[model samples]
Target chain A: MAENQGVLVYLEHREGKLLPIALEGLGAGRRLADTLGQRLSCVAIGSNIAQLASQAIAAGADRVYLMDSPELADYQPDIYLALMGQLVAEARPQVIIMGHTDTGREIAPRLAFRFGTVAVTDCVELNIDNTSGRLLATKPVYGGNALAVFSTDTDPQVVTVRTKAMAPAVPNASRQGEVITPAYKVEPSVVRARIVRRVLAESAGVKLEDAAVVVAGGRGIGGAEGFKQLEDLARLLKGAIGASRPPCDSGWISDTAQVGLTGKIIAPELYIAVAISGSSQHMSGCSGARTIVAINKDREANIFRHARFGVVGDWKKVLPAFTAKVKELLAS
Target chain B: MNIIVCVKQVIDPEAPPSSFRIDPATNRAEMRGANPVIDPYGEYAVEAALRLKDAGGAKVTVISLGSNLLREVVKKPLAMGADELILLEDAAYDGGDSYSTALALAAAIKKIGQYDLILCGREASDTNAGQVGAGVAEILSLPCVTLAKRLEAGAGNLVVERVTSAGYDVVEVGLPAVITISNEIGEPRYPTVKGIMAAKKKEPLVWKPTDLGLDASRLGSAGRKVKLLRLYQPVYEGRCEFVEGQTPEEAGANLAIKLREAKVI
Candidate 1:
């Protein structure tokens, strides 16, 4: 067995490009690796993903491990878990950072269990304890009402970083790195709980997590028709539309657009919350926005607590004027 | 078919944010005046199990582990049509991280010894670790798919519509698998009055660490590999600048003007 050293990032990719969270996690791993005077390495696994190695290298990695196989095209937990287990044994990284994404959520804990350990997940902050030389992960708990700091002594401390919580690694094409193709094999026969089909969500233009501006509604918007009016503002601002849990659960919008603790975590330039009471669960997702504007009839609504600017009125009456004024200001 | 669901009693996450408090001395949260309730996500798990039972003949067994677990809160699942309830109630089970919690739950599950499926919320509202389900699955050496929005039984396997960032994937898994339920499963059906009456008459089976053949080191805080260094509420030090106008419509327009002036667009 090799000595546990260096920081390794588990890179997640869709289609041919890396997810934003992947680069974010890489940037975070880079800080830790540099702080510890260790090399930063990353591994990419999928079909025809040998090309992503260079991308990973550009994103602050000193070395890149590439594993590409047709059977590994779609993320099957078992095959990926087996491969990760083997790689951990070979590289023996001191810390493994993964994005708190769909794949990360599935693989991180299982992999830690294989190592007889536990993973600190959905972390917003990761630090190297100067005294103990251990990884400290701070995460939001109680539906974002409180934050808890945790640390594990086990080797190869595993962490899944929340999306947008860390700065994305700046691509440096001139950065020097090497790509190594690790031993790879896929035995599909050993896999269970396989994905048979996918019903891709119908979202057009900007995504909720990446949008510069987001116009979101809540139960006070009444129903689907009210969301249509919010959509008018979203279009005017060239932003995506989101919702609180009630609107989504009531079928007013896609669950993909729900922004809360259990849904998407977003950090946009501007977030326009219309008639949302701003439950801590909902605010946890968008509190990172640069500016928040709330329009609601109730003056004492929780939404005002988090907003930078507010209009105390029905969204039906307030939104039209807000949209028209924003249109005029942008055009001028 | 037999199904097992794991539920947790948590400080009501719906309580007003002002009521949210933390005891830094003990590194735990104390909801000033709020009562505990069954985790909303766990309620979704119960709903999933109940739906499976509704579709076919199955017995839904509910399990919870904690200290000072309110009977009304833990019995919510039973009122939701579950056939049986098991409680691992003891002080030794408190303060366990996901690792130790999974150990206790898994041990209890092994004692039950008959389960076709295991369901859990994606994460509890209090801790929000989102690891217990997968931890239990790994402990039991079973397959687990997280964040399911829809589920159905087909032949000897299950068809689950697992939620994803981009969309939903149709998954097929054999019997004796674990799945974590998400919010998109839809609001859990309300427990009818008759069901509540029936729940009032039912007494849950309670167990201690000894009953599960486990001891202190593996049961709770002593067994926790991840230590809670500190817990506290994040302060919103900044102030909210309310934009007011003669009329609501003018306020809306002024809000737009303020954004432009701040160059925050």
Candidate 2:
């Protein structure tokens, strides 16, 4: 539509490492491009991103567009929006796939509105409409209580896929692709907001994203001290610790550890939900786990509905015994 | 200084999963017994505005758009100390997507004619699209900040601790910008008895599409650019296998043993 040619994905990176969700975006773009018989391209914008270009190629990009500059180190919404805007004018892609990330959330809608279009965000699934050749995006609404499929008729349809919703493409070192360095022409003055300071929460031991097992708690944990017991179980399994919104809001745990639709979306090998009621929002995050186990006092707690194995008992009485038995099982 | 905070009334997000239901024909979520509430996320935005009002003599005006909105529900902002309440409630306002929603809100803001800052939730608990605030800013041609944990308003500029994927960034922008508040702002203050009494006596100002001078084509569902093809609830396979023993302590041990046997640990 409107002389648009191919599918373009926004390759987002942080701390010199490409975000996994960006690669997932590529996987989704590759499929749609292949179906439409159009080339799939990705744009990597940031400083010192030469290494990212090759990775993007391996991850299924037919062409990699780069906007590398020292000034592009940190994400300024206006600057990035302008850069992408210029690229859209030049490349004329039919679709733009981006992560539902901090940058994408700001840029997708703004970019769509700039081009007199609309962006369907936090999409869990995407496809091409057979008759109209329009992009169809399926996103979760009402905190995962419902799912809605949306479509737009405008060219260069924009969408931000939910983080970790799609599996990434298999990377091949031998895959051939071309790298193009586009002229970065956004004026520095366009950025009205300036970053004064940056602070990252200190995470201990295993990161939540990479953890094989996750030990999460809820309001039933009662206090910060209860998390210490959960921590013991997590440590024994070489896993990470997570919690429901209450623990995070109650100051029992850092906000980063909160698991829900709005919080971190994790899919671990084994997810042990202790003293958690397992609301739908919480289930949206960890439902993808291979095997879910629940330890809660209430027999009717919602967590049990999703758990593969469950025990109905107070965490205080059950966790210590559970920990001891696990300690002995591991030793043997 | 004048400030506007945009809020929404929606099906309670914290409603028990059992009561949640989807109307297949309408492709919408309805509750069998749950009542609607001010979006949990928007409460933080209201809290952000009230805090600004607490610090200075600024007047905080709250704007909400929807159909069949409850008075006691939408007026919660006033009960929490906002100075004014405006509602764009009409059947025509129903079935709109984020784009149309932002169009009407921006039009209403223009009609009000005076504002130094705009505030909204990072996302509504119901839609969770998180686009309306940014869309409003883009339409109004103003700088916007999304997912701000905390904010401090200065003389001509406001400093906000905006949430990023990695952590957080402190950003400073000129006044007359939009800020989308995150839950990290801390718990919103409950409406006091005095505040609730004050809210009951003060009637809110109501404005429909005609009131804002927007044509029918540019209002509500008619103005939507993105079309919803289908809305449905996902089915879950709940087949939990319970591992138990005679006693609670024994059940705990049995669970661990069961996991080890299944090679799950």
Candidate maximizing DockQ: 2
Question: Could you give candidate 2's per-residue lDDT for residues B21-117 as a string of tens digits?
Answer: 9887777787678889999999999999888888876899999999999999999999999999999998888888888898889999999989988
Candidate 1 CAPRI classification by DockQ:
medium
lDDT per prediction? 0.89, 0.89
Candidate 1 lDDT over A191-245, as tens digits, reads 8889889888989868998899999999999999999998988988889999999
Specify the poorest-scoring 10-residue window by lDDT in model 2 chain B.
B161-170
lDDT of 2 at A324: 100
Residue B244 in model 2: lDDT = 88
lDDT for model 2, on a 0 to 1 scale? 0.89
Model 2 collision count: 0
Q: Candidate 2 on A94-147: residue-level lDDT in tens?
A: 999999877888789889887877798888898888898888899888888788
Off by over 4 Å in 2: A14-17
Model 2 chain A scores worst on lDDT over the 10 consecutive residues at A188-197
Candidate 2 local lDDT, residue B110: 92
Chain B TM, every candidate: 0.98, 0.97
